[model samples]
Target chain A: MSQGNMNLTLKVWKQKNKNEKGRFETFDAKGISPDMSFLEMFDVVNEHLISSGKEPIAFDHDCREGICGMCSMYINGRPHGPKQGVTTCQLHMRSFKDGDTIVVEPWRSAAFPVIKDLAVDRSSFDRIMASGGFVSINTGNAKDANNILIPKYDADDAFNAAACIGCGACVAACKNSSAMLFVSAKVSQLALLPQGKIEKRDRVLNMVKQMDEEGFGNCTNTGACEAECPKSISLENIARMNREYLKASLT
Target chain B: MSEKSFFLSSSIGKKISMGLTGLFLISFLIVHVSVNSCIFINDGGITFNAAAHFMATNPLIRLIEIGLFAGLILHIIFALLLTLENKKARPIGYEKINGSANSNWYSRSMGILGSLLLIFLVVHLAHFWIDTKIAVFTGKADKHNTFNEMKEVFSNWYIVALYLIGVGSLLFHILHGFQSAFQTLGLNHKKYTPIIKKIGLWFSIIVCLLFASMPVAIFTELIK
Candidate 1:
């Protein structure tokens, strides 16, 4: 390894299933290469766990590439560990030094109940989406992408909102446990799209209603969600959502 | 629990309360500034004092005052609870919080600034509300002249300075609070987010400047 080697003490959460009681179990990881990804180090730890008659700490992961938005973990005290815009799988051990004591936990929102160990059931995100995330485009109603001819400004704005991956990191990071950023992104993405114009009012109304139903906290404008988000989603989305809601309410 | 009733149970409900209460308080600021501006219209403070006396006694105004008190209490309570929850949520700070550089400074310090503003509110109510209420109840002011009372209060340079600093903190808070309240209500579309944010900033600055100007003008003898 080009980077120096290091040892770490891991306090990993272990739960058998959603209903199971979980606790932190300590493990010593020595001979870890600093360049190894955080998940890679986890892999080494898991290998040791399996060989030592222990169940490996189960976690949710799909794309180690940070794009899947599946790697949700509270590293030290931050969501997706400490590295900005990087998932836990993408974070390298080089960010830490030898003999570091790493504390890993799951997202702590009431909306995000733990499924097991470091994995949380983020289906609340899916529910919020199902309430009103997409345009009501029907089959055989295909339209040319450029036919709508949205202004460049609107196009760019929609793209920024569409970049949200439905991760619950914002909820995890917000002091109020607010999901305004996520709901606003969904509302904004469609509101900006030309095809979404037909249902803009209904879209915001239903999504916000569902967001409320899901038990998310109100946004206090603290911006912790934006600060900790792996996607760098802007708080501007929340402002847009507010405008949409106010307009919708008037109608 | 019933799904429809879960709004109150959800994190989103807490946010909605925070937003609504915050916006409501901002409206109170507008009224307060307007009433305070009456002082400029009356150089001898007679007209302003009469108006202030009328406002203090009006039934409608009293009703709204109760609402305002409820709003302030809820705003502070929820703010404290939210801060504590957030602290418990992320027990450790990040190592390299990437993209944090992109967020606005006001957005990050909502809690700290809010606390300072809360402290300012306590002193403000004590200096103004308590004394005024006491005077109103006792009918002790020279013909119920609240403006004279205000003049006495603002005559102190330290009091004026404190009001200026307090309003300044409030301005900083509204800069973030206005937009964030909307976001909490789930208003996250991009087309208008930037415009709302700009409006929030300008609104904060304008209102704070106008309110702060009262004490400043009084202290400088510009309004005498």
Candidate 2:
């Protein structure tokens, strides 16, 4: 009820299943509270839908904390609406003014098929990660974190790269559909860590190989992924990934 | 899932093909720039014209041209297909982006800049290559050397202006393309990555500017 001062229209994508034809259906959102989170606003709309005996729009969401990255709606032409570094769940109704039109839809990628109205199958990302994401650390003994003693610079870089949430927003924002940012982040994360250094060459080669195999486009270096990423992951990671791959190839 | 199976897929194959072909095009620009520098020699116009003529008529060069064209076609096709796929992959834009200082502006505008370069290439080929090659083969052009045709075309102000703009855009393209192509090839590293990127930028700028100067000199009557 915090957004009660504003009136808005919601143009949301609706689909019964993956094979179902989807369309944007509009709904009136009046007396919305300004303090309501985007998801909370959705709850209000769904309440209205349920009361009217309408099938509520199904969207992927979990943790609502932005770390889980389960919220994958593209709002108003941006991955997480216009707010930078905020996930859809973290976005508040105050981000918009009254009488604004909000367009919500799921991620669109061949690799990510729509499961329903606003939910998509992001399993391709899992497959990409499974390709070569983790280092082969022996699980029998728990080593102290201090034992690694990686350079400060390397640790920072690795941490930055690891910040990627496996959100497919970068792939969507890219004009060439390049996943260089995502793949590079994964490659760089492991490549920077000492544990990851052992299989650095193989890891980068395999992940890049998997990325290409997934039918993602070549990295045209458009930097859109970096721009659109909720984590604000740098393109430098992609550059770093490139450097690792080249070294791997030569070795 | 397996490495063997992964590399064989058309997507991977196409990306590899694009990376290699793009690298080849970069190399061609270097060679083309070197040849174009002959305009500065002032050897009674003999040296430059001879080089130009050889490029136009040499069998080996023709073979290379075929490869170049193939690379160009594949690169464009793959680029288009990839864009369409990416469009499908992320129908929605992200809500918040964190890192912006990590990449150069040129790196972000590669697609738009590349399309511009492609348009420029078509115009360039039509004006220079098609005009001369087709005219020569079909007996429409007089028996003047290819360099003379170039000179005549370059003498026009509009042609000079167009060539300059094309070359400027190409310079921008190469600046980003050189670093990007390497990244696509998975060449990121801490020790030597920055060095390679700097080299890529300088190479692109110098080569593109060198080629661009030829038309400028001709238009200014400095070559005559």
Candidate 3:
């Protein structure tokens, strides 16, 4: 009832490990300051649990900023709280009402198994990246950055695509739990760049093949990923990746 | 993946099929709408009857019609499979979700729109296509009259209302399906996609409006 502070109900998913079943456990989060970040609120709850001699809820997060994409929490049906274009770490308690019941869970996808609580094993993304997300070049002397003479437009697109933070939010927000947006961002980043063109032919094919192998769903162009994406990754990258994949498959 | 499995199994490959078949069906709609638009010739159904007769008698058009049916069947089957797969992917859904915040209703309700269109198609085929084909094959060739069929079907207010409803569903379906097909096939370009989307919106409106106008015109005696 105090100004700038709210009592909230948190429904958080809890799991012992990847092999254990998960369930939602409710807890009272009282007198939370509006300025506190979402993670900070959870930290308070964890501290309370620890003080009470109960096991603290486990979650994955490193950088409290939005850059790392490690704060993968689904809040109230959205990938990262109710806000658009932000990671869970960047979400503040002010977004919710005083008595809001926030439901938090991990990314639900066949490819992303829950490790424990809100943390999931996102190694499938790493495997897909390792498949063909690299380019080979003989290193000699450091060439001037302008030696390649990249177009400004392509550079902009490459930079935009490169902004993907490897978050599984796209998979979580998607109705089909597809990872097309993430994979396409990586594909577009490489394909749009002059330096990444050497392996473009094999890169899209390999990445998509690996993506399918990981049991990810197909992109239905629902636009959920682009909307929920912390990096604002466009669905155009998926189209571009599709173009690349088709060309690779045909030729 | 094997060549067959690649097209049948992979997500992108399945989308490619949806695109190809969708485009094929779109092309069929243009032909169908054009042929039906002959009703507006206002020549006492003479021009429309002749056009319909020509379509029925032409061997090449007949062959292409077979392909059109095949394409339609494939498009429907793929749509169903994709819908099922997508449904299975999210076995447990969210307690609270906002669909319209990201995409339009038509894009999200493709399966539902498609089902409505399917119902409309079945009624349409039962009313006209089946009757005409039966007349052709049952040695009742002289009874084959598509113009009279149109006049008779539209005379009833219920049938006219149904046709308008069907056209309405078709409008929403094609509005999303048009550009979505292009996006799925990877035909998107930064420079051209906005243009494509605009064209798709107008195309859906114009085509469905034209078709819808036919039923209204006939029912109102504007064409008669």
Candidate 4:
């Protein structure tokens, strides 16, 4: 009640490990600052739990700055919690009113198994990348920026696609739990440039195959991934990947 | 993967299949609505019957009709398979997940909408297609007046209402399915996608309204 601070309740998902069933545990977050990032508020709750001789609530975070793609967990049914175009680390407490019960959960997908409370193993993305999500560039020197001239429009689009942080929010947000947005972003970032053009065909095919093998669902073009993506990755990337896949399969 | 298996195995392949078949069905609807709209000429059943008869007996049309049935069956099969796989992809669901927070209801409900349309199609074929095919093939009806048959069918208020409901389902189905087909085929463009969506929206509304209006018009005796 003093200034901008308020009390809130959080129903955080708790799972011991990958094989265990998860459940939500309620915690009182009192006198939380309206300006605190969502993660910071959770930090306060964890501190409280640890001091009370309780097993501290475990979640994932590396770079609290949102670019690490380490911060994840659904807050109130959204990947990054109700906020558009921001990661959980960037989501501020002011977005929710005091006395509101916020439900927090991990990204639920067969491809993403929970490692602990609020932290699922996103290594499925890594496996997908290993399939064909790269340009086989010779590693010697950093090429000059203008060595291969890319049109500004193409560069911007490639850059936008490259902005995906592998957070799995797209998969988390998708009703089918589709990995199309993530896989497509990986495919588009390379396929747009000449360096990545050599592998465009195989890249899409292999990545898509790996994606399916990982048990991720097919995209129904719901646009949920693009809508909930913290990085604002475009659905256009999925379309680009689809085009790439067709071209690969046909010839 | 081999090219054969690529189209048959990949996630993209499944979607591409869905999109392709969905577009084919949409094209079928275009022809269907156009042929049925002959009723709007207001000359009773003559013009409509001629068009219907030509469609029923034409060899090339019959060939395409087979393809149409194939496409619908394939569409439904792939839809069911994809929906099942989609459900499996998330064995553990969000306890408090918000679907409306991200995507439109229709976009997520393609399976449900498609199922409704399929149910309608069965009754529709029973009412019109089977009888006409039997009559034509039996050589008992040289001048098949399907329009009179339609008129008779629509005279029942419940049938008219059911037709409207079917058309209503078609509207939502097509609204999402139209541009979704383009996206699945990777045909999106920054310049054209917005235009494609706009066209899709109006196309769904107009096509469905026209189809719905036929039953309403017949029931009200406005066209006959």
**What TM-score against the true fold does each predicted structure earn?**
0.72, 0.76, 0.93, 0.96
The residue-by-residue lDDT of candidate 3 on A151-214, one tens digit each, is 9999999999999999999999887789999999999998998889888987877788888888
> Candidate 2's residue-wise lDDT over A76-182, tens digit each?
77778778777888899999999998888777666678899989887877877888855677887888879868899889988988888887777666654567788
In model 1, what lDDT does residue A3 have?
47
Instruction: For candidate 3, give the lDDT of residue A191.
Output: 94
When summed lDDT is taken over every stretch of 10 residues in candidate 1 chain B, the lowest stretch is B1-10
Q: Which regions of candidate 4 deviate over 4 angstroms?
A: A138-145, B1-5
**Cα lDDT for residue B113, model 3?**
84
* Candidate 2 lDDT tens digits, B1-224: 22533342434444555677788888888778887788788664678767776777778998999998988888788777755665554454433332243346666666677788888888888877886687657764445366676788887888788788788878887787776676666565666679888998789777877788788877777876
Q: Score the docking of each candidate (DockQ).
A: 0.24, 0.28, 0.46, 0.70
Give the Cα error of residue A30 in candidate 1, in Å. 1.3
Name the best candidate (by TM-score). 4
Candidate number with greatest lDDT: 4
Task: Please write out the lDDT profile of model 4 over residues B126-216, one tens digit for every residue.
Answer: 9999988998799855657788888899999999989888888899999999999999999899899999999999999999989999989
- Summarize candidate 1's per-residue lDDT along B1-224 as a digit string, tens digits: 11232444444455677889999999998888888888888578877777777778788998999999999999888777766755544443333233353356667677878888888889888877887788768876446666666777789999898888889889888988898776767665557778988988889988898889888887777777
Please give the ranking of all candidate structures by lDDT, highest first, separated by commas: 4, 3, 1, 2
Which lDDT tens digits does candidate 4 get at residues A144-242? 878888899888999999999999999999999999999999999999988999878878888888889899999999999988999999999999998
lDDT of 2 at A210: 74
Candidate 3 vs. true structure, TM-score: 0.93
